[model samples]
Target chain A: MIKIEHLSYHYSNGEQGINDISIEINSSTSLAIIGPNGSGKSTFIKCLMGILKPQRGSIILNNQNINKLSITQRSQHIGFVFQDPKEQLFKSTIEQEIRFALRKRKDQKDIESQVETILECCSLTSHRSKHPYDVSITQQKFILIGCALGMNQDIIIMDEPTSGMDYKGIKQLAKIVEFLKKEKKTIIMVSHDLDFISEHFENVMIINHHQCIYQGTFKDACRDETVLSQGEYKLPDIARLSLMAKHQLCTTHQEWIELWKKR
Target chain B: MAQLELSNFSFRYQGSQDYVLKDINLTLKSGQFTLINGLDGAGKTTLGYALKGIIPHVFEGTLLGEQRLNHKVFQEYTHQELTKIIGYCFQNPWTQLSMIKSTLEEELSFSCENVGYALEETRFRVKAIVRLLDLSHLIHKNPIHLSLGQLQTIALGTILVLDPDVLILDEPTSQLDPLTRRRLFNHLSDLKKQGKTIILIEHNIDDFLELVDHLVLLEKGSILDQGSVIDVYTRSLSIGRDIQYPSLTALLSTITSLDKPILNDNDALTILKGVKSHD
Candidate 1:
C-alpha cells in the first residue's frame, strides 16, 4: 500500500503545482488519475517517483518513507512510463531496451529469459530485433512499458499511454493492462482517454486546480457531473449514452448494449 | 479549382524498398475541413508531410505524382513560398518547438520572425492566435515548462500565426483533455469559417464528425475510402474497417435499424427518444 500525506509541491516559478493532496492506494488494484492539463497529475507522479521531492508531507510505501529512499531504491518499488515513450526508449533494439533494466538487478540472473517473457507479454517477440525507432509509436510505447515490467516493480505508473494511439493499439494496450492486473501488479494511469479509463480502472482520482477534487469508483466518477466538469473531462461515450438512456453508467459498448437489451 | 490537389502520388524514402504512400489521389476545395483516419503506420503523417511540400524537399524521397495548390504546380514553389501557403503541425508537438524561445508568445512569434515579418505584424499575429486559442494565461510562461497539452496548443498557435491558406495538423488534439480538445476544435471551426483549408489526421473523430466536410480513410499507405463524412464513416463501419466511429453513431446503429448517420450527441438522443416514443 502507498499512503500520501498532505503532499505539496511548488514549481520553480513559485507556482503551486500540487497543494495539500492526500491519498492512499491499496496494492494489487488499478487506479486511474484524470485531470485537465497542468493540473498537477504529472507533478504528483514525479513526487511519487522521487524525481521531485514534495515541499511538504510524506509518501510511505509499504510502511517505509519513500522520501528518504535513494533513487535506485525507490525505483525498485515503483516503475514509471513517461507520457512520451521517446524519453525513456534509448536502446538500439526492442530486446535490448527491455533487457536494459533487468540486467541492473543483481537478483535477475536470467535476464535473457526475463526479456523474452516480457517481449512475449507485450506481443513484440517478432519485432525484438527491430530498432525501437523503426516500430510504430504504439509499439515503441509498449516497449517502454515492457521495460518497466521487466524491472519487477511493485507498482507501475503509466502517463497517458493511450494518447495518439489508434483503436487497434488502444485495444492491444487494454489487453496488456488486463494481463498486468491479472498478475496482481498495481497500476496507476494518468490519462484523458476516458473510454480506456472507464473500461479498465475500477477506482479513479480526479485532480483539478492543483488538488484532488474527487476520489471514488470509476462509475461514480462518471456520474459525478460536478467533478467531471471541474476536471475538464467528459464521460466516455458509452457512459454518456447510458446516462442519457436513464440507465446506470456503463463503461463499455457491450455493457451499454446489455442495458439497452434489458430496457 | 481545388484548393489543393494530388494525383498519382506515391513516395518512398531514399533506399527504402517499400513506399510510405502509394497511389494517393485527393482534392480539397477552399475552406474544406477534411479528416484523414488511418491505423498506426498507415502513412497519415507522411501524407500530411507531402501536402505541406516537405516530401521531396526536406525528407528526400523518391516521389511519383503531381500536386497543385490553387491551380499552380506545388513543386514549382520554393520552401519559403510553400510556407506562405501551407502550415504543417507535426504529430509530435515537441518536434515543432523552437527550443530557443523563452515564452509562449515568443515561440508563436518565432515563425513570423523567421519569415521576416515586420515586428508589429508578428506581434499582431501572436496576439490574435493567443486570443483565438484561449491561451492568454500562458502567454508569458516558458513553453518548455508547460504541459504536453499546453505545448501542443503553443505549437499549433505558432503555425496559425502564419495565417497560411492550408493547415495540415497531424493529431493536434492527441495530448489534450476532452474540454481543451473541444475548444481546439471550436477554434478550427472558426478558422474554417474564415476560409482556411484544414486537413487533419485524427483518431478521435467524435468531436470532429460534424466539423469535417470530408473524410478520407487510409489503409496501409493507400486510400481505402474517401467521400463526404457520412458516406465514408457509414461505409467504413459497414465494411468492418478497424476505424472508430462516434459512440452515438455506434449506439444508434445498434439499438435501432437506423441507416441514417447520427453526427452528434443531440441527434442520437433525438433518435433514441423517437424509438422510445414508438415503444
Candidate 2:
C-alpha cells in the first residue's frame, strides 16, 4: 500500500507542482490519474518515485517513508515508465533494455529467463535483438514497460503509455494492463486516453490547478460532470454515449452492447 | 490543381530488405484535409516524410516513384525550396523544437530565419503565427519550461510561421489533453479554411472526422482503403480491424442494425432521438 499526506512540491521558480495532496492507494489495485496539461499528475508520480522531494508532508510506501530510501532502494519498490520513451530507453537492443534493471539486483537469479519471459509478455520476443529505436514509438513504450516489469517492483507508474499508439497497439497495452492486474500488481497510470482508462482502471484521481479535485470509481467520476469539466477531462466516447442514452455509463462498446440488449 | 501528388511511390530505408511504403498513390487538392489512418508500422510516418520531401532528401533510401508539387516533379525542388511549400510536424514534438532558441518566440521564428526571411518579415510572421495559435501568453516562456501540449502548439507554430502551402502533421495531438486537442484541431480547421492543404496522420479519428475531406487506410505498407470519411470508416469496420470510431457510430451499430456512419455528435444525437421516438 502507498499513502501520501499533505504532499506539496513547489518548483524552483515558485510554481506549485502539487498542493497539499493526500491519497492512499491499496495494494494490487489499478488507479488512473486524469487531468489537463500542467496539472500535478506527473509531479505526484515523481514524488511517489522519490525523484522529487516534496517540500511538505510525507509519502509512505509499505510503511517506510520513500524519501528516506536511496534512489536504488526506492526503485526496487517502485518502477516508473516515463511519458516519453526516449527519456527512458538507452540500451542498444530491446533484450538489453529489459535486462538493464535486473542486472542491478544481486538476488536476481536466472536473469536471462526473466528477460525472456518479460519479452514474451510484452510480445516483443521477435524484436529482442533489434535496436530500441528501430521499432516504432509504441513498441518503445512497451519495451520501457517490459523493463519496469522486469524489476519486479511492487508498484508500477506509467505516464501516458498509450499516447502514440495505434488501435492495435492500444489493445495490446490494454491486455498487458489486464494481465498485470490479474497478477495482483499495483498499477498507477497518468493518461489523457480516457477510453483506455475507462475500460481498465477501476478507480480514478482527478487533478486540476495542482490539487486533487476528485477521487472515486469510474462510474462516479462520469456522473460528476462539474468535477470532470473542472479537471478538463472529457468522458470516453462510449461513456458519453451511455450518459446521453440515459443508461449507466460504460467505457467500452461491449458494455454498451450488453446494456442495450438488456434495455 | 492538386497541391501535392504521389504516384507509384515506394521506398525502402538503407539496409532494410522490405519496402517501408509500397505502391502508394495519393493526391491532395488545395485546401483539402486528408487523414492517413493505419496500424503501427503501417508506414504512416514514412508516408508523411515522403510527402514533405524528406524520404529522398534527408534519409538515405531507395525511392521508386514520383512525387509532384504544383504540377512539378518533387525531386526537382531543393530542400530549402520544399521547406517553403511544405511544413512537416514530427510525431515527437520535442524532436521538432529548436533547442538553440531559449524562448518560444525565438523558436517560432527559427524556421523563417533558416528559410532566409528578412528580420522584419520574420518578426511579422512570428507575431501572426503566435496570435493564430493563441500562443501570445507563452511567447516569452522558455520552450523547455512549457507543458507537452504547449510545446506541441509551439512546434506547430514554428512550422506555420513559414506559411507553407501544405502541412503534414504526424500525430500532433497524441500528447495533448482533450481540451487542448480540440483547440488544436480548431486551429487546424481555421488553417484548412485559409486554403492550406493538410495531410494528418492521426489515430484520434472522432476529433477530426467532420473536418476530414478524404480518409486513407493503410495496412502493412499498402493502401487498404481510401475514400470519403464514411466510406473508409465503414470499410475499416467491415474488415474487423480495430479502428477508432465516433462513439455514436459504435452505439448505433450496437443498438440498431444500422451501419450508417455518424461523423459528429449532433448527427448522432439527432439519429438517437429519432430512434428513441420511434421506440
Candidate 3:
C-alpha cells in the first residue's frame, strides 16, 4: 500500500506543484492518474519515487516512510517508465538495456534467464541484439517496461506508455497490464487515451490544480461535467455511444440496433 | 479545381527499393476535414508530408508521378510559399515553434517576422489570431511554461496568423486529454465553418468519426481505403475482413449488423434502445 499524507511541493523558484492533499492507494488496484498537463501529476510521481524532496508531507509505502528512504532503496519497491523513451534507454543493444537493470543481482545466470523472459514477454526477442534507435518508438517503450519489470518492483508507474502506438500496440499494452494485474501488482498509469484508459483501468483519479478532484470508476468520472471539463477528460467512443443511445431513445446500443433492424 | 491533387504518386526513400507511398491517387477540396487513419509506419505521416510539400524537398526520395496544388506543380513552390498556403503542424508541438518568445504576442510577431511582414501588420494579425484561437489570457506567459494543449493552440495561432489556406496536423491530440481533444475538434469544426481546409492524420479513428468529412486508410505504403466514412466502413465489411472501426462504429456494427456502420453516438443509442425494447 502507498499512502500520501498532507503532501505538498513547490519548485525551487517557488511555484506550487502540489497543495496539501492526502490519498491512500491499496495494493492490486489499477489506478489511472488523469489530468490536464501541468496538474502536478508528474511531480506527484516524482515525489513518490523519491526523486523530489517535497517541502512538506509524507509518502509511506508498505507502512514505511518512503521520503526517508534512499534512491537505491526506493528503486527496489517502485518502478517507473517515463513518458519519453529516450530518457530510459541508453545502451547499444536492447538486451543490454534491459540487462542493466538487473546488474546488482547476485547471480549472472539468473539475470540472463530473467532477461530472456522479459524479452519474450515484451515481444522483443527478435530485436534483442538491435540498437534501441533502430527500432520504432513503441518498441523503445516496451524495452523500458521490460527494464522496469526486471527491477521486480511492487508498484509500477507508467506515464503515457501507449503514446504514438498503433491500435494493436495499445491493445498489446493493455494485455500486458492485465497480465500485471493478475500478478497482483499495483499499477498507476498516466494517459490521455480515454478509450485505452477506460478499457484497461477500472479506477480513475483526476488531478486538477494541485488537488485530487475525482477518484472512482473510469466511467463515473467520465460522466461528471465539472470533472470532465476541468480535467479535460473525454469519454471513450463506446461510453459516448452508450450515453448517446441512452439519451436519444432511452435504450442500450444493442436494444437500439435491434429496433432499427425491425424497422 | 480541387485544392490539392496527387495523381499516381509513389515515393521511395533513397537507398530503399520499397516505396513509402505507392501508387497514391487522392484529391482534397477546400473546407473539408479529411482524416487519414492507419497503423504506425503505414505511411500516414509520409502522405501528410507529401500532401504538404515536405517530401522530395526535406527528404531525399524517389518521386514518381505528379502532385499539384491549385493547378500549379508542387515543385514550383518554395518552402516558404508552400508553408504560407499549406500550414503543417508537426506531431510534437515544441519542435514546431522556433521563437524564444515570452508571450503569445511575441510568438505571433516572430512568425510574421519570419514571413517578412511589416511591424504594424504583424501586430494587427497577432491580436486577431490571439482572439480567434482563444489565446488572449495566455498571451503574456512564457510559451515554454504552457500546457501541451495550450502549446498546440499557440502553434495553431502562429500558423493562422499566416492565414494558410490548408492546415495539416499530424496526430494533434496524441498526448492531449479527451476533453481537450473534443475542444480542439470543436475549434477545427469552427475553422471548417470558416472555410479552412484541414487534413488530420490520426491513429484514433473513433475520436473523429462524426467530424471528419472524408476518410483515408493507408497500410504498408499504399491506400487501403478512401471515401466518405460510411463508404469506407461498407467497404471494410464487404471485404468480409474485420477492419478496425472506431469504438462507436464497432458498437453500432455489432448492434445493427449493417454493412454501413452508424457513425453518430446519438443515433446508435436510439437504435440500441429500440432493439432492447423489441427483445
Between candidates 2 and 3, which one is better according to TM-score? 2
Query: Model 2 in CAPRI terms: which quality?
Result: medium
Name the best candidate (by lDDT).
1
What Cα-based lDDT does every candidate model obtain? 0.85, 0.85, 0.79
Consecutive 10-residue window with the lowest summed lDDT within model 2 chain B: B270-279
Q: What TM value does chain B of candidate 2 have? A: 0.92
Model 3 C-alpha lDDT per residue in residues B92-175, reported as the tens digit of each score:
677678757777788878999998999999999998888776678778877766655667767877777887889898887777
Chain A TM-score of prediction number 2: 0.93
Candidate 1 local accuracy as lDDT? 0.85
User: Residues A58-149, candidate 2, lDDT per residue (tens digit)?
Assistant: 98888887777766788878889999889888998999898886886665567877887899988899999999999999999999989888
lDDT of 2 at B225: 84
Ranking of predictions according to lDDT: 1, 2, 3
Interface RMSD of each: 3.5, 3.8, 5.0
Model 1, A1-263: lDDT tens per residue? 99999999998889778999999999998999988888899999989998888989999998988888876779888999999888888889989888787877665557767877889878799999999988888888889888888887889999999998888888888888988899898999999888788888989998888999998888887777877888777777778877876667788666766766663
| Cα-based lDDT at residue A187, candidate 3 | 93
Candidate number of the best TM-score: 1
